[model samples]
Target chain A: MDYSGNGKQFSGKVVTVTSGKGGVGKTTLTANLAAALAADGQKVVCIDGDIGLRNLDVVLGLENRIVYDLVDVVEGRCRLRQAMIRDKRLPELYLIPAAQTRDKNAVSPSDMIRLTNELRPEMDWILIDSPAGIERGFRNAIAPADIVLVVTNPEVSAVRDADRIIGLIEAEEKGPARLVINRIKPAMVKRGEMLSMEDVLELLAIELIGLIPDDEGVVTSSNRGNPIAIEGKSKAAQSFRNIAQRLQGHKVPFLELQEDGNLFGRLARLLRPGGN
Target chain B: MHAVLIKPGTDRNGMEISTKFQIKGIREGLLVTLGDAPWEQVYAALIEHLDEQRDFLKGARLALDVGNHMLKAADLGQIRNQISERDLTLWAVISNSPTTERTAQTLGLETRLSKPKPEPAAQDTRYQDGDPAILVHRTLRSGYSLQNPGHVVILGDVNPGAEIISGGDVIVWGRLRGMVHAGAGGNESAVICALDLAPTQLRIAGVIAITPQRRGKSQPEMVRILNGQVVAEPWNPKKKD
Candidate 1:
């Protein structure tokens, strides 16, 4: 079967995006990162390793057109070219969708390795969207990742899961994983209702890459099958782009939207003066 | 080629087809390499070999190296099932092809023999390289045993049935409720500190200490080698200096 090598490179390296918790924006990051990288002229293919709960296709807006998936290619039922759903907007970007019917057991870690190894020769980056949980899906996604970006939010459960995932990653000899804190609510953080960046960092204690604030636009865009990162104006979009740029070896600054959530909230309150 | 390759009875030849397979211990586990021919022949030969030397290889960890025949999960699973039927654990299957490797992995088998990890931290500690320690930042789940020949600084909880073995010291930033072995390399100076130090059993150097039924208020405590014994004491900010 024609397994296309990773369509992007960094000093010719493929990086995979992963998270330990379910529904913690792994797909969102993978889709946006691929789009952002492709926008910068890097050939990228985001492989959704979350087979059963495959949402990369949906988030990337390639859901309706998916005919074959990673399992199909791995099982040799379809050619890899037949499975890769090229992005409508980006000429260089691609999406290797995951099968929605099958569970994580459908593909093995080595199948992913073979697939990624084949893709490594062709692409600039093979950004695999790892499924949540520190199980088989996680292993498959990380098996061939030259770099793993562990995504999390500023929440206790998410941070705990991230820590576990990081430990498992290190145990597998698969990390030195970088961190991406997603969907952090600045206002809640300030009032002590949410975990601040320091609180999350104290628990994770990893090199921070991107700080994406909570954006309602992400929901609307996903509903329209458009990833927010593809839209240039949105804040979350900018976050994904910066992450992609950093992955390309650019020294991008982490967004300092809020130093401590309370300060930002206090400033907002002062500016508003309780008019509404 | 098959006829010529086979040794006649027990006589001298290039390789003996009739010869019993050898099961010897390698660093990883029992290395069992089947002769290349048909899988049926190899399977039968392995069982026969096991039967003959049942006493010698009982309850041993095994790793089978099946050279380049793309085995599906069921094929590898069957081998493991057969091995388990004989009370042997098949821990790994070393393969050359990606397909075989995938199958082995799908069957939850190790792709490589467990090579002894280079004890970098341990080596660093032995040289007294500025309080060498390994830091962990996750919950140690059940059945997880971390053996560091240096100090261990954990940023999370150590659950029951988990173990931490350190040569120098062990510190849990979170609660510690596991079996811990400090002074693992027999160094008596090792100590263990935890937010709530209620361990199933704690050992330091040659001394073993039990938690005193955990009656009092929970506090950050340190267990150290005091008066030639391991003692648990309330951690004091002013005591160390």
Candidate 2:
């Protein structure tokens, strides 16, 4: 929350979280990853880039403290620091809520770039929660990122959209985007009703960053306006933590998808070129 | 946004009325050849044509043949962006001016038309090779379409929603799951072949066919018009006698 972290000499990195389809857990992943990174002693800020459909503040439980939002900052109605809502739980985490009244045209891609440039010298990570669909909103979110994480589900529709989004990212020269498969049900996959991880990876052909299981704890924590990464021991929470660690350049092995697959299975899969 | 200018000599309500631009169906999509006039006037005429033919031109890939027009980067970029807003993709720009060609290249636009021409004779004056086909080396994802006047050869996968239309034969060295049209200029003998032929739709001249569900594993298949009907057969090198 310190905007004046001068003399530290560490430039912050921008990471954009985007999904081509709606209701695909982009906001959940953003909130949890921001929380996990902050807990790991990295100063992080989450920018809600959904414009009129802003929900990052609500999910982060910082809705009540918002006096200014992204539109206010871009329109020069408030300073960058004045619009950032510092979290009450984690001292290092902050939230920049979006304006609920204006549409995506209220902000431009250059505005996001300039704002991130101003915040780059002070923080460790700047996370932008991109809106669904490939429009001006999506372009605004990705214009300022050093890395992009494309979130998708295991369904055919989600993978199809992810492929299109990946193609667009590559066209913009911002790819290859990393993939994070969320809300995966291992039981359904075993029953031949869902797409396996290998199927998704084969089609996407991108680096696999994280796999989040379907956990009811995510809904419960969201109802209470708290990310599970900050207060739970669920497998989903652990996966988000691992993603945060991977983002920090750590060599963390992927967690086994099956219930009985142990460390040896994971290690063997890693050793083989196309094992799983 | 201007009122369309119909060519003189035809009836006002006639469907055969001409404009300042000529649009012909090509393998790649629709090729729009502009008349030699002021660039601004030609651009305005083109927009009016697209607006008047919006229903017929929706979702069409367009290649502009701007002859001898020395265009700046900003001008070409603006036109490309405006074309996309109209639900049309301007992929190639054929120009005679080197400056214009360089500008189009800078914008990542294709500057060559698929025309069979002899390569610059390097070693022998009597030997020449005329291959009009272009070998694309990357996967064609959704929303991408390639059109050519000659044969088209692809070395990568063609994902769903991607399209390839060629005036001659079409061949894919990898998976072909998208739509394809060979002999788009009405050559009935044109053939379409793929390593794995599971196209959404296949067209040869006047014929159209959809792929059937496979019984087991995939195999190399060739599709062509046989006895006035589009049919597929397994491609076996040993069967060629």
Candidate 3:
């Protein structure tokens, strides 16, 4: 099973943000990636693949506005158009909110593929937030994905989960998966309390796409339903924005995550015009 | 005396000609098709062809592709004994004519090509293009397997659980701690080498070796079949100089 990175150009690209372990920020990356892609004027749709415990609505600040969930649309109770909850802020951004009442078995891989093919003609990106573990939900998430991005934190346990995910992805022929090491704490790494980027890269041995440092603003922004990439500036926001740009085919240099406050300057961060 | 066996004007002298190309090599260490002519001339041409490609045809896998020549197993066995006198093997008889094929099968001669052509990697321009094998310039991790019929030279490590099964030699620039089988078709001369010669299992031709744990650090090592057993020794291409 080998997935060549061949389907990245044109049409709607499905990037499944998956991690094998829970609480490793799969939803955060999904929510932010959706926002990041939409912020660039590309029409984007985020499918919350965690069927029973959906969070794309809450993360994208559309929880109260959800009229119908993914299962309703999949089971044909409602039109496919009725289930998509559009974000008011970003005209190009939409969310096909997950079903809370039912489990992941509510949608199948074929169903996901059909849904994605329908969305393909209208959108530029469809980011699937895959549920944790190598189960049916994970299979459904990656079923329609053109590129699989394995997200993990810079910790031993998170890395183990990522390795397992990478193995599974390769077996599905859905990979040569790229890695996104999220929630990297530079200070902890410097103090040797956390795993370094090199250590994680060594074990994973996959091409790293982005390294997002742990930021306090991420939680507050999630609480308010606006991703940090669009709001108050942080290294993490720039990281996500750079990732979005990279997804759009721009090659961006990696940001050096250093927290010693020393004279050695970090790589230039691309500050967008929206905010500081 | 034998002028009547000739077709009138074609050769008044009645001199026989066996001019078609003969691939008289062993199919599985057996002398297969020698040139097929009229029965007596066919045997004569076979003897002559054996004398010409003497060194190149030595000890090869051979099968005879006799076109419509029907002969009893005793007759074929007699010819085989003759070839065996010269250390040639008669393995298979490939024949379009049913009688000969049946006879060859009865004599236990293989009748078909071994297998279909090997399937190379997808997205490999070299798979369809002329390059037989491509150089992989990185380490092969666990669960990563490479299947190439041509020689495979890796510039990095082959970790445990990884495999490199090649139809030719496999040379690893770094540590080789994985399973590697070279000359997979039983070519005994194929050699495997690495900076740290510590494979979970090493195979060359029909011989296999398990690298014993060394007490000291790793050194460059090479493995080859010696006296019909796989043996690994220190690799020092420069130490001799």
- In order of listing, the candidates' clash counts read 16, 3, 16
Question: Taking the tens digit of each residue's C-alpha lDDT, what string does model 2 give over A24-143?
Answer: 999999999999999998999999999999999988999889999999999999999999999989999999999999998788777888999999888999999999998879978987
lDDT of each: 0.74, 0.81, 0.74
Q: lDDT at A53 for candidate 2?
A: 98
TM for every model, in the order presented, reads 0.62, 0.74, 0.55
Work out how many backbone clashes candidate 1 has.
16
Q: What is the lDDT of residue B182 in candidate 3?
A: 80
DockQ of each: 0.06, 0.14, 0.02
Residue-level lDDT of model 1, residues A1-276, one tens digit each, is 111224433333557777777878888888888888899988888899989998888888888999999999999999888888888799889999999999887887767878877877677778898988866687778878778888998887777678767765655556678899988888776655677677566556677888898888977777677777776587778888988888777777766677553444445433432211
Shift of residue A24 alpha carbon in model 1, Å: 0.7
After superposing candidate 2 on the true structure, give the runs of residues whose Cα lies further than 4 Å from its correct spot: A1-9, A262-276, B1-129, B239-241
* lDDT tens readout by residue for model 1, B1-241: 1211222233233445444334445766677765565777667777766776578778988888777556776577557756764668889888888678755654456777763333333432443658778777676743467766668899988866578888778889987867998877777767788998877899987889887677646789988888987788898788765
- Top lDDT model: 2
Q: For candidate 3, write residues A1-276 as lDDT tens digits.
A: 223135744577888989888888889888888888888888999999999988878888999999987899888999888988889989889999998989977787778889999988888888999999877798789878888889999877777678767766765557778889888877666655667677677667888888898998898888888888875478999998878877777888878678556311121111111110
- Which regions in candidate 3 have their CA more than 4 angstroms from the true location? A1-10, A259-276, B1-241
Q: Give per-residue CA lDDT, model 3, range B1-241, as digits (tens).
A: 1111211122223543423224522334443443455676767656666676579667655566676677766566556545654557766667777666545544445566464234333322222345465477767655466666777899988766578887667899987877998877666777898988778788875677787776455689888888888888897768755
Give the best candidate by TM-score.
2
Find the candidate with the highest DockQ and give its number: 2
